[model samples]
Target: MGISKISEFDCIIFCVYAVEYRTVSGVAGPLVILEKVKGPKYQEIVNIRLGDGSTRRGQVLEVDGEKAVVQVFEGTSGIDNKYTTVQFTGEVLKTPVSIDMLGRIFNGSGKPIDNGPPILPEAYLDISGSSINPSERTYPEEMIQTGISTIDVMNSIARGQKIPLFSAAGLPHNEIAAQICRQAGLVKRLEKTTNLLEGGEEDNFAIVFAAMGVNMETAQFFKRDFEENGSMERVTLFLNLANDPTIERIITPRIALTTAEYLAYECGKHVLVILTDMSSYADALREVSAAREEVPGRRGYPGYMYTDLATIYERAGRIEGRKGSITQIPILTMPNDDITHPTPDLTGYITEGQIYIDRQLQNRQIYPPINVLPSLSRLMKSAIGEGMTRRDHADVSNQLYANYAIGKDVQAMKAVVGEEALSSEDLLYLEFLDKFERKFVAQGAYDTRNIFQSLDLAWTLLRIFPRELLHRIPAKTLDQFYSREAASH
Candidate 1:
């Protein structure tokens, strides 16, 4: 048994704990090997007392009878094998959570980095939460408008769905992520009116944003933007900078998700959890795997990478009788823009859909540069039309997709054969494509558009083609929206 002392006002308190094993036989990377230990459980918390009387935190990674390997959260740089004292806490890692966590800033390990008072937690949730069972989940049927036209009109995000943004290294995914944080919501419209209505507090919308392996400058940008936009009051920010201990990266998303679950399932708040640069999280897993000398899978990643990712991604869903829901948008940068990379390829299988950022459109100075052709939301059909978004949403989305696809094919042909050789009908499609890119896809950084405005803009663009060419749209929809004056112009 170990005895620890705490000093108070002119008094001392002694606490008893489990045996402190002082036989740390080896220290390698972030792991410490302790010999002659008994009854160590996997994932149990371990407190390592240094020679200076300070302590470092770790979790037991593996337990082999009388021996155990622990992964230290603060790393093992100054750990001394001969003098370190390891005390098993007999509990797994957990973080304190409450509704008060909103607007709070925390490090990857769930400690407060902001200059504020500590949280009086309502409960301490296990960091490694179990996935929601598929049989208990409800199908996603509500739309989440991001206020970005490409995502709102073309590939609409649904509540409780897990979608991802597939970006490259240099792509402006950070900016896009911040924008979504500021603008995403479950838009409410007045009965028999097109005007947007503000949902009551019962709607309970919130955001849980986690950034892993980002630099300080990037972290500041996220904080400043959220504060300026008045979103900080409802946002919970978890930042893991590049300079912090690498092992903390493995815990950042889990901590963020646990907080989200608390807010959603307990507080009845609809939560949107955004995880940026998932590639960093994966890389951290690779480093820990290499340290353990585990057999490597594709690209030197751990073979259980898929299962690990599932534990995180599968946490997003609406329980059968719960009032709140968890919707996830996990952003990952594809190495060399290769979607076939192990990271993105596996994500595609687990996630419902993906939103691909276009490098070509970015070069043209487009703000978001979302490529509409390849981007999709599998649950969009279930969430749009009559009561959800608009009656014309599905038709407008279909028409826009068909026309833009044809316009792109014509553009490729123009490069092969001169524009002069193209028929007059082809020229009209070429012009339609130009207008579509300029008017529909492009928007200002802070420009916010509701579902009505987005649908109106799609109709304006579709009018460029003759009414006969608009075969994808229904006749009743055309008669209502396709005016002769707009078509002639």
Candidate 2:
């Protein structure tokens, strides 16, 4: 009989013939230490069988000659070191991939928890996918409209760019993320009107959303939001609840990225991977490091936290000869609103740019309170202007930044000298600051705007200043878009 058709007895005999080590030396929280292990590879999957004939899954975190440290995914609370057996699977952890993954809800370990049918594997891909060669990388230039004025106008997201939303606790970052997932796409009107510029094809667009260590309420909110907006069809969601095993948090993003890679590279889809509350993921890493008795770096995180984060962030990009691309918008809440905290600090160095959400704005009742000045998209310049968004996009953006800077300076002066002491020009700038925050940066949570509408609104605001003060915009652009009647204000 073929090996595949072997009886249960034969299978047991084959398992008995395979190498098994009963050398579990110690259990530390979620980790298991194995001594006298021979040639155990790092990241190798291990099966731990207990005395009750139940098996748990684990991964080899470290292998030093004959000693190996394994992190159990299901925790090690009930395992007895004397009777447990560890068997190395001779393979790294992998996730099954298929096009049907869209609209499916998965747990942290990539297992479907929605009571849906099992995933029919088209292929199995290593969760730790190989990095794209730098030589094979294509520069990201296409603009992705999130329909939020602050993001669309100022910190524009681009295809294949790793842009993170740096937020703090109690901010509306979740609402903003949900809005983007609902409204993000290439503007079809722009494509139809300006055929010369590159635009995202609707059919090729997809989203992979991974929420790590969120509470049950937060998870349900995201699901309801997606389902209500009818965006679940294009989204592959991975929810790692706060109550789930902390060890599983480390694997959540990898699973999400693996599915994104399958969709983008193999299935030729433009995928946006949204990872939220990365602080929780980082905390999980710190916990695992502590469990392993490893020395901690800044803020008790692992010494290799930066390198480990790079493994996840660097997965987003465009490869040469591939029609699809992966763009990442990772969201992490700054601890105590401290951006200098290790989590946000390390992420800032790895990502292309960041979108900062302000607490002050949220407190002011602004729905999507994106703080414009501190936020930026480094790839925005190449992705906007001429045929891409609009001919006046770059000029308008620059003028808005310049005017907003001046307005902020004037506001500071007003606060120091009192508003009564301010000149008419300073007062005008003060008004501009207020209007900019209220009208430009803030919008209703569900309201969506295209590039044209956002730019038009920008022009309307800029016209509040005298035409002579608008030096950033070219004369021709002024003639084309400027409204002289509104400039009288």
Candidate 3:
């Protein structure tokens, strides 16, 4: 026995895991080389020394007997199989998840990172949580007013909806995300520093931000901004950077959503799950599918890509009985601004609506360069009203969308036949279009307007057009909407 122990510690051999018969020739992990068998599927389990100097459970994925493969519960990144010994615990893997984890941040593997004490173990839900039945879903009625004119008016965001922001490279999608997180909740109380709900709803609102494969600088920026803005108190951030393994990219969203599910469903909090840069997640799936040698789908995507996305999108909703609802805003970067790309196309089909970003607006130096015409929120109308905010809010939004859409078309036509050939009315539309983009769409620092100001500005611009041509608007709206120019005319 003594001789065998020494020889095994010093020897190197090939290993195959039990379940998949996966091989580990030079695969070094936290697990110490134990018994080696001929093939896989051994009921006998092995153990590994965890990073915390405590032991945890794992399975013998492959057994060559003395050189068996162990499927680690926690991944092996810094584990030194040389010194960190392995004792087969004879168990698979499990974690605790119950009512306690309301406001917590965890890694992909379900370990907390809030600098707090370890949680008391309880019933653990799989990090990849299950979705609610579609038949069980209630119709979405509440609108999520982003307070951005382009978004609030044109594409009205609704609560419990899965809305994705589609942007090209070099766009300020990150900035937009940060802005939403900052302004989304109520204002932070300056005097009541300890109070969690100074300006925002303390009991109901919380943000779950998951950054997959972003750089450290970007992660730090997001963390720092949330903290500085006081959104960090209620915000739970899960940061998975580029250096993390490819397998981690797949688990990142699942883990983030799991945390969100815990907070939203169990804790009774209105949850906002923001997944930035889904393209990274898709790439990881493609990598794994390629490794598995599976048949590829369109543009090398997996055949189950649509269903895979549905699994995530379906997680956002209001269950029939729960007061807490989970709303999701997934941000995806289009490849070369290709809307038809599988990532955006499949996403557009799955989600309730999409917030499309315009590169041309960025070229014009517009902050949050939202092209409102093409961008639409499927659930905006339910939230705004004279009682909700203003009576004119809906009408002004309709007019702005109508006029801007025309303006966009007219500008394109003018480009074909030089501006000289365009009619006077078309020229006015052209001027209105330019002014609309600059004044309303393009916003500067310290220039945030409430819903009222945004609607008022839209009316002011529409008044420039002849009132007779305003067939898109209700006559009641025209009679009630007071424009300074209209009074003068």
Estimate the TM-score of every prediction: 0.94, 0.93, 0.78
Which candidate do you rate higher for lDDT, 1 or 3?
A: 1
Candidate RMSDs in order = 5.7, 5.1, 9.3
Q: After superposition, how far is residue 160 of candidate 2 from its true place, in Å?
A: 0.4
Put down candidate 2 lDDT per residue, 343-362, tens digits, no spaces.
Answer: 99999999999999998888
Colliding residue pairs in candidate 2: none
Give per-residue lDDT, candidate 1, residue 127: 92
lDDT (C-alpha, whole model) for all candidates: 0.89, 0.89, 0.70
What TM-score quantifies how close candidate 2 is to the native fold?
0.93
Candidate 1 residues lying further than 4 Å off, grouped into runs, are: 1-17, 189-203, 484-489
lDDT of prediction 1: 0.89
The number of residue pairs in model 3 that clash at the backbone is 24
Q: Could you arrange the candidates by TM-score from highest to lowest?
A: 1, 2, 3
Q: Model 2: residues >4 Å from true position, as ranges?
A: 1-16, 188-201, 484-489
Error of 1 at 212 (Å): 0.4
Per-residue lDDT over 1-489 for candidate 3, one digit per residue giving the tens place of the 0 to 100 score: 365455655867779443322223333433323443343345344455545676644556445544665544445654553445555444433446544554456655566776867777556656557768878776665555454668766666666778899988899898888877766632221242322221223457888888887887888788778777776777777777777665566667876787778777788877889998898888877765664456999999899889988888888887878777788999999999999999999999999878988998898798879887667777667655544455666777877878888898998998899899999999888888988888888775324555556666677788779877677787887886755754343
In candidate 3, which residue ranges exceed 4 Å CA deviation?
1-106, 110-123, 185-203, 386-389, 445-447, 485-489
Model 3 residue 63 distance off true place after TM-score fit, in angstroms? 16
